[model samples]
Target: MEQNWDDLRLFLAVAREESLSGAGKLLRLDPATLGRRMARLEKSLQTVLFVKSPQGYALTEAGSDLMQRAERAEQAMRAATAGVPVQSDQLTGQIRVGAPDGAANYLLPQVCAAIAAENPGLDVQIVALPRVFNLSRREADMAIGVSAPTAGRLVVQKVTDYHLHLAAAESYLAQHPEVSAVTDLQGHRMVGYIPDMIFDRELDYLADLGVGRVALASNSVSVQVRMIQQGGGIGVAHDFSLAATPGVRRILTDAVSLKRAFYLIRHADDRRNARLAAFAEALAVGLRAETARLEAATAGQAAPKA
Candidate 1:
């Protein structure tokens, strides 16, 4: 049987993502279509490519062997296209950005909107996930991460630093006993990230702030913010996000605060794409302006208590 390069490409996407939905997300194909393509590819090759379980797609021995060949082909294709001239002034196609919920909710929309306004032909997809993006797997075109990638064929640049603090709704504070010190935190209900589901160490805000557990928990920072807004419990919030939400007031502001940085990450092979370069520059500019406001909020200037 003749080899199908397109089938191999689909195989590679599934291999990289380890799940049909994940690969479909990258390829912009339906999960069922990806599954059928994989099935056809397996039939043509006369070997089992994957072992599907609830956990996700896992490669078989045959699939693992094919992966090496596929990766080599991918590299060659990238090299062949590297020299092709791209229009620097016109941006088109999709750029997917993966980021943690805090930055995704508070920062990326405005930046992406401004970029889209300038290039009507461009589309931006923001995956506001609470996990680190794996650049080696082509999980996203660009990613905003809490920490820079230390090892990979990647380029990392510091976007900005922002602050976080323990906060509660003013109504909740008024009704509950005063939280005058760190020890008082233990006596109150807390809203926080699910302890075991936290993908990054930086998100373990409760432990860092001396609280051992939360009364309410979720995997999303946006959910935590909403929980705090509803007077569910005291929780950690980014100064930037909390600044815009009314009725939330910082607690133990002088005693408990955290500073974290964001990084712009891109695969080294994509470093020279003009559209990517332009978008990255715009992202940096937007982050700078937003972080300035975030800094001011930390200084007790942005959102005043009602």
Candidate 2:
């Protein structure tokens, strides 16, 4: 019995998703049917590919080895079709990108919208979550991260560097003590990421300000910005985000400034995929332009009168 390409495709999906239901969802097959097909594949190979457990499917050692080869085969198949004629700008496939809520909510919507407008056939799905995504598990085809990852067979491209500063709503600034220096932040109520839920060290914005706690905290960036907008308190906020948000103004521009960069991450194998490469370039270019365009608003808004 020989291994079939379609069977290998299904096997790869199961290995990545780690469960019948997860793989079924991605492949659009019922769990029972997927299980039956997996059983058939195992029978042909005369090996147990997965061990069932409470956590779902755990790939056997043999299965892990097979996964590597299957991935190579998948890449080869994609490369084979690279020479086929297609519209240069029109891409037709689903690409899922995961990012922390800040960029996902504020930046990506505009960047992706523009790409989709140009490539009408491209289906872009954005997953906004506070924590880092597991790219190896196929949680997303690509991810945007605040920091570059050190481990994983992944390709990382630094997208852009942006700035952040302590900010608060005009109404809050009016009622609170003036923030002329970092020392002034001591008595003010602060709103920022939940102390423990800060996903990346770079996101520990408040702590960098020498503050340890938040008067009001949420894991979501959009929520923190809303808290600032509602005059909750001063928080370190992205200048790009503050531009889109009304009523929020930056404070202590010279004293409490922060710089951060965004990185675009993809599987090591995806470098061979032409479509993904093109999409990645477009996204990176769009982000650089968008960040510059939005940060311009920061130039016009006067720092609060101290």
Candidate 3:
């Protein structure tokens, strides 16, 4: 027999609430309207689904049995709807990803290229935000964030540790001769990420260095890197950002080593979605490879000069 899903939803709400008024409030319908809909549903089914009493409404035997079946039907319907679009081993849907500006600049391009190469049908959209995106509301299919999310419903994987160091433009270093001590930072015009936008430890580090005032401040890591390249000022950046940039040079100091982990996060519910899974896997692999390359580059720079 054909059944209306809306009626089933109303029935489930009434059954769970055990009161017509309560269910109406839950569904945002007037009590009279809810009563009329329930009556019509009972007439269509030709059964007394609820017993009205002074206390409230209670589900009858038929209604209880129907409630159980309806709940299962709803679960099955949701699963079926989600599963239909995804074919096994065939990735083909758009995956929206949220990432920080630095990661987007230094890492995401290669990952997107790899995903596109592996699954031509998959579409990837990257949104670079300085703050975290809400995954519970499906703001993004996946997120690469600096902090490990404490939300229980999210599946988080620690992708890799990003190494940060101080960098200065070659021209700036040429102008101000390298002093072999950390205290020498006092004389340099320092550029930095905006205080509120920077991660906590990095901000604290800057504070501790007595460089309380910024020569230049920016929210975007790419912008910060560019400003440093143009000899705007000295700033902290991930090793990868300065690797290929011609005018930037790393400032080697023992106090400058900072590392933060990158986390791959997605809702637990969407973890099984084929497109999201494929993209996440490809992204993780690509990021790890990039991290290794950056490490090797850093090591080479640290090597003794012949």
C-alpha lDDT score of every prediction, in listed order: 0.86, 0.89, 0.78
| lDDT by residue for model 2 (76-170), tens | 88778755666566887899999999899888999999999998888999999999998877788899999999999999999999999888999
Off by over 4 Å in 1: 1-5, 19-22, 30-62, 297-306
Name the candidate that leads on TM-score.
2
lDDT of 1 at 38: 93
Pairs in clash, predicted candidate 1? none
Ranking by TM-score: 2, 1, 3
Which candidate leads in lDDT? Answer: 2
- Model 3 residue 143 CA deviation in Å: 0.2
lDDT of 2 at 275: 83
Per-prediction TM-score to the true structure, in the order listed: 0.85, 0.93, 0.70
List, residue by residue over 37-108, the lDDT tens digit for candidate 1. 999888888999899999999999999999988887777776676567876576788888999988899888
Higher-lDDT candidate of 2 and 3: 2
The stretch of ten residues in a row with the least summed lDDT in candidate 1 is 297-306
lDDT of model number 1: 0.86
What's the residue-level lDDT of 8 in candidate 2? Answer: 94
